[model samples]
Target: MTTKPAIIILSASALAMAARLATELDGEVHGLRKRIGDDAEVTFDDVAAHLVGLFREGRPIVALMAAGAVIRLLAPHLGDKTREPPVIAVAEDGSAVVPLLGGHHGANEMARRIAGLVDGFAAITTVGDIKFGVALDQPPEGWALANPETAKQVMADLVAGASARLEGDAPWLADSALPLSEDGGIALLASDENVNTPVSGLLYRPKRLVLGIGCERGCDPAEVLALAKESLSEAGLSAEAVGLVASIDVKADEAALHHVARHLGCPVRFFDAATLEAEAPRLINPSEIVFSEVGCHGVAEGAALAAVGASGELAAPKRKSRRATCAIGRAPHPFTESDLPGRGRGRLFVVGIGPGSDGWRSPEVSQMVAASTDLVGYSLYLDLLGPLAKGKVRHDFDLGKEEARVRHAMELAGEGRSVALVCSGDAGIYAMATLVFELLDKADGPEGLSDGARRIEIAVSPGISALQAAAARVGAPLGHDFCTISLSDLLTPWEDIKRRVRAAGEGDFVIAFYNPVSKKRRTQLAWARDQLLEHRPASSPVILATNLGREGETIRVVPLGDLNVDDVDMLTVVVVGSSNSSTVATGDGRTWVYTPRGYARKEGTAMTNSFSGDAA
Candidate 1:
């Protein structure tokens, strides 16, 4: 197969599923190594050998296709240093679907993603898997190969009453672990149905949950099930593993959440609209319509949170999602107000320094920085904020040292000082604002930071995330729900990054990619470009911005097919417009881009005015 549309090599059944998904998504798929003879078979080994060659050739691999043998054979080759492509495992009988590796770090995620491409459900069987609602070790992708000794460690931790904090919406869902303390500082809780009672440790009752949910008007059953699965994935818990189902009264009769309830084998309780309306205090951006119609800002989100909070379950970290995979858990004890006593409120501002110029820096941001007594940030980012740093205590650190920076800022803030943790561009868009609140979720971590550390209040001020600056410099490309994906596989693994790229492609959302490529990280951008090619036309516009809002900035708008990989690096930001964003060249060498809002295409629209008193 030439890999037109997308090149996929898998079992016949998987191929069939892929074909169906391509049709549903209005895309195409090409299968490599199709069976030719009667009773012929394509095993995992054949696919692995083909992939090894492909990887060596520096060709992009969206996902791998195999049965059981692929990961085993690929294991030795996939040493600690090398990066593996996304892997999706197919049963010979097509009875089950498995996302075996990189669930979040990327492989398993790829399989689940392919299943999405084919519009098929992956038969996830991991225990405490948030999507399927199973245990962490039981996750399908890693189960076959996870170390025998590691299981003992996990069990030992659980037996010792430690908390397992599931972070993302992966089938292999969960981050690091924290042992529940005997002094009641932290407690342990289960995200699955199989709860084990340890002999001596304190069961940490953490009170937070990240709910991954999808619902339709009046509750379409499938949407509910999808929502439930997503909620489990978001919360890093299993759907069948939930303690209860809290939803709006309208969905009480809705078949899907009910089906999910049955699948979870849990009780479903309907919350009145008033109850949801009253929960506004617990919500960040509660919807009036949702509260009026469904009786809750987030039925699935609220339900998951309520279940965990009431049970004193540990809170999971926050994750980003197109839908509402909100994290709600028990409020940290002594949840003091931001304006408490002598200390300045725990404020987190995602300050955007407006490109590289001091002129573009918002006055509000400057004042806030001046007003703060302590500063926290990457060394380079701190260098940019030097004007506001004249008298403040600086906590400069290297790149990728985010968690420590946040903790120090909080510790400083708790010590009664106004603190500002700085990030370039928009603070909230892929910045420190998120990390501040993530640290606030004391329930989930390698270990809970000291209570004094958790007392800091956090707030996020908006800053420009490179996309806005790049768009304006080129043209109006971000006039819609565009997303920003960092291509750096340092903190986030490449496999997860690829899955997100595929999702963005499938959703047809405009994309602004940060940290697009580096010398050692050449393949990611190419892989991302190849994946985008599957859904978007090769002629789609790509805007490359090097040193945006800074001196020596170079901006180029080119067709996706003609994008030059050499043009990007750590200093560059890549803007890939959605299908709607278009390019038009002027009489000169310059080109301009714009996204149409579709208002011009409306029928029965009149140009003449017919107001209350129109005299012509």
Candidate 2:
């Protein structure tokens, strides 16, 4: 009854008759062969050989076998081959025929063509009658099974002659779509699962899910997935039902997208900024960066809405469902309204002005500062923001005075000013950003001045850390897990510094010495080096960068045993490479640092032994 085309097979004597009939009926005969004659270009033997080879190599094959005894011999020859091309058995007299393997992988179409050759019927076995949904085995090969059991169930239902329904309407879906029926019908859901369907209905929503996130600035995709996963799990959704993923257009070329797509075994679709902007009704509080880039509100709301629409759940009301319960787990970090736009959302951009060069400042950071109304930072940092501070109010203070600066930034932002609290290097690496958050946590601090102050938003943008630039200036001597220690005892005790230095040496971590030897505090650096010598080899490479990237820049690479402690001052950053980090001296007397990639070819037990210590 299906209006699809079919292939027909007939006696060799009847082949001329069938071919002529097909030509007259506006149909063509596509033949197969095992071999090609020298003058013929290709023959029926070549087609048969190609089909057999496809079966042998596990490629999907479409074969039309006549009801004659030839199929019995061919089926056994298909033996031991885990993959078989689809084979449709037809009667030579143009009677009924059924497709066997790789039906959706093009076998059905192939059979239909052949059925016309022999004047037979092609029985397609898939359920959804509209435009037969992709078959279980015929889906893109690399796609992983989000729910193997559900797939199995679908097959069982089909074999039992149950009708299948295609739920949820996606614009990308073909126009011949049909509504899903509740009477034990299978639902063909698009990638996203957010439909407004109620629970207790025959339709079951999947719980195991994946959230695809595309971020502009400041948002880490890894962290976003982690948080979204945690939220879904906490909501009683299984980690498995998340057959859905979400992302913005900017991440179209990101490796992170392929990584997630391959893991979920789902196709990814990107939405333009305008389409997503229409879904921003719920995203009332959007960030300035998000607004400028995505031209909309939060990505989560938009992505979630889009995903739900894809899953055929958009028209269904949000209600409890009973097919299965997926738990939504607690998130490591929760998004707040302040994380939205225009809310006392002050961000701490820890910029690593590489080598203190103007060319190294990122254009994005420049735009952020230009958009700010106030700047909170040390006097040195105030100078760094000079170009962008033409119209902005500057709350500059002295060095070693961070509490006041953090307080003022929060206060200004509380009054609705977009503030940028600056740090010299990466704000997170023992810089001003961490201190700001620590103060923000205190109930009595400036961050908690009033209830109106609660919505102040905060963020940290990574910059070039002092150690990275210092290492590049000297040599590649810092190629291991390294610990940085500030020698100043102003806030931390000297005894603690000595203990940490010894621990770093014992653990074989490369040590980046910060605030190493100030003019007034010369002995601390010597004492720290002495502590390191107790656990590390004396021949370790010790690199010192003085006035790095400034007018009086001096980078020195020396052995740990020959380090001159007195030569180092607060402006100097000292790096002592670990034992694993090798030092090679070039012909020009320059030494470089190098670290091995650990194990490369080891497999099985040998690989286990290599990482066993870390596992413990």
Which structure among the candidates has the greatest TM-score?
A: 2
The 0-to-1 C-alpha lDDT of every candidate, in the order given, reads 0.55, 0.52
- Predicted candidate 2 versus true structure: per-residue lDDT over 330-366, tens digit per residue: 1112122222111222333334344444334444455
Number of the predicted model whose lDDT against the real structure is largest: 1
lDDT for 435 (candidate 2): 65
Model 2 Cα shift for residue 474 (angstroms): 3.0
In candidate 1, stretches whose alpha carbon ends up further than 4 angstroms from where it belongs are: 1-350, 443-446, 587-589, 599-616
Q: Residue-wise lDDT of candidate 1 within 1-616, one digit each (tens)?
A: 1111223445455555554544443323334444421111112335666556544433324342554565665566664322434445554333445764434334344446556554556855443243333333333421221122344355455645555433212222233333223343222233232234333322221212223233564555555556546545655453333434445444433455556656654444444455545545555545666565665675544543443444343344323343333333432221122211112223444465656455456656765675677888888787776434655788898876888887777777655467888888887777777777777776356765554455444556666667888888877878767888989888898889989999999998888888888778898888889899888877678888887766688887777876778877788899887776777656775676666564435786422111111100
**Local error of candidate 2 at residue 385 (angstroms):** 4.1
User: What TM-score does each of the candidates earn?
Assistant: 0.41, 0.42
Model 1 is weakest, by summed lDDT over 10 consecutive residues, at: 607-616
